[model samples]
Target: MAPTQYSQPERFRIALGPLLYYWPHATVLSFYAGIADSPVDRVYLGETVCTRRHEMRFAHWIEIAQMLREAGKQVVLSTPVLVESDTDIAVMRKICTQGDFLVEANDLGAVRCMERRPFIGGPHLNVYHADTLAWLAELGAVGCTVPVEMDGPTMLALSAARPAGVAVEAMVWGRMPLAFSARCFTARHFRLRKDACEFRCEGYPDGLVASTGEGQAFFTLNGIQTQSATCLDLCAEVSAMADGGIDYMRVSPHASGTGEAIAHLDEIRRAQRPASPSPVMPADATPSNGYWSGRPGIGWVAEEAGT
Candidate 1:
């Protein structure tokens, strides 16, 4: 007998990545509760960024995972990106060892500890080449997210070249997560150092918007992270993505109306609905889909409702 080649079932699936900001504990719980009743196929639950944002602890994540599982949804735990100390690595070990659902390995450290259980290769893991995908497969990577900067054609090529049994995912929605940093940009903006930042990043429900020379919102200085000012919107390109071999589309979390966001994605994935131009208008937040165009992630391309 030979190994089976990977095959997608010819349908799109929406996955909700872990909430990136530092929201209140109650907000986190109620958020997942809303997702439990939504139509997203898989939901990633865990902190993928700074370790200081302890509002959602390991146990809380596990509890949420169990709740999502019980609600008939697939769950994956995402590990943090920058592991500055042994304590963070220890937490990573705990998450990998839990063995409840798929663990999304955001860095090589997490991959090293994920013993044989099929895990997801988060975008933080530089997965540009087919060989990288192959290497991760050897370590039991079941699915992997392509970096946000890669254009559609480049992503299509990668999808075609993926190793056997591996699925390729992309962050089609939300502000483009450009890079992570050792210093906290948000804290500095509020006149505080990293150690005593007082969770100021939480204040920006989206992110601290930074603009260009013309005072236009260009990017955001998040806590040890940099994100595009405009949320990456791919509402118009979901069909084209389905045409490509991309398997899953990830919608990163914001502060409010995440359930509605997940539901809209489910509509497109199921083909039970048509593509809409504006995403959940007047919902206290807006969307941008220009990253899929391969231009500057913030650049917007206006399309008629169903172009």
Candidate 2:
């Protein structure tokens, strides 16, 4: 069958991506408690990063999902980006078979585990074309998040040719997850083995920022995941996204100021105007939107540049 054409929603939707960092159990609960009352239309839960961060097990995530559902928000469970061990596969199976909440499949293994059940294609699924989107839709993907490195025009083209009933989501905010490895960089950074690393990632709630020899901010290391040094803020592109048939704008969770960030984006979406480049990051962090404009991932292209 041919790939389905893109369909736009009457109103733009905002989703909270899965928490990529490891926090204490209380902190995680507290964060979602606040999210239950936020303007976010959907909330993605579960550990999409390393599974060693066991602050919240699958049951705990379900509990949070139940609470959020009661608050009138849609919830999804996200599988890990990298599935290294049998334990990971087992967890993925548990999440896929639950049939309670929707699942976001980050890897193909998770996709297969879902057994044609409706799920969301996560950013790491590497879907970059209409054919791939169509294949995923055939496998029961209700929506697919564009890869972080996909440029804006490319996303528009893909959206234009996407399969029917498959909505397109974009990562409009947060430090972009660049890559994943079986080896935990955080463990190596701490001079310990990956298995004996003693949960050091929890120390850096926002991931550890790697710097160049010249002290320029480089990649951020969060266990097995490598991320951009600067947060990707596409709030300024909300109007363009709406014009291009994007269905949802995703904001990855951060340690602080996420509530305010969600609020700011909500206001811009409701007003249906050009965004004013609000402060979504902490005072110390930098913001970049170059990937959306077909520039280097670290570069920030101004709205007036139009290039």
Q: Candidate 2 — worst ten consecutive residues by lDDT sum?
A: 2-11
What tens digits encode model 1's per-residue C-alpha lDDT throughout 87-173?
788889888888668899999989989876789999989898888998899899999999988777888888898887998898877
**lDDT per residue (tens digit) for residues 187-261 in model 2:** 999899999989999999998999999999999999999999998888877767777888888998889768877
Cα-based TM-score, every candidate: 0.90, 0.94
- RMSD (Cα, Å) for all candidates, in order, is 5.3, 4.9
- Please state the error at residue 41 of candidate 2 in Å: 0.5
Clashing pairs in 2: 4-162, 4-163, 4-164
lDDT of each: 0.79, 0.87
Off by over 4 Å in 2: 1-10, 304-307
Steric clash count of candidate 1 = 4
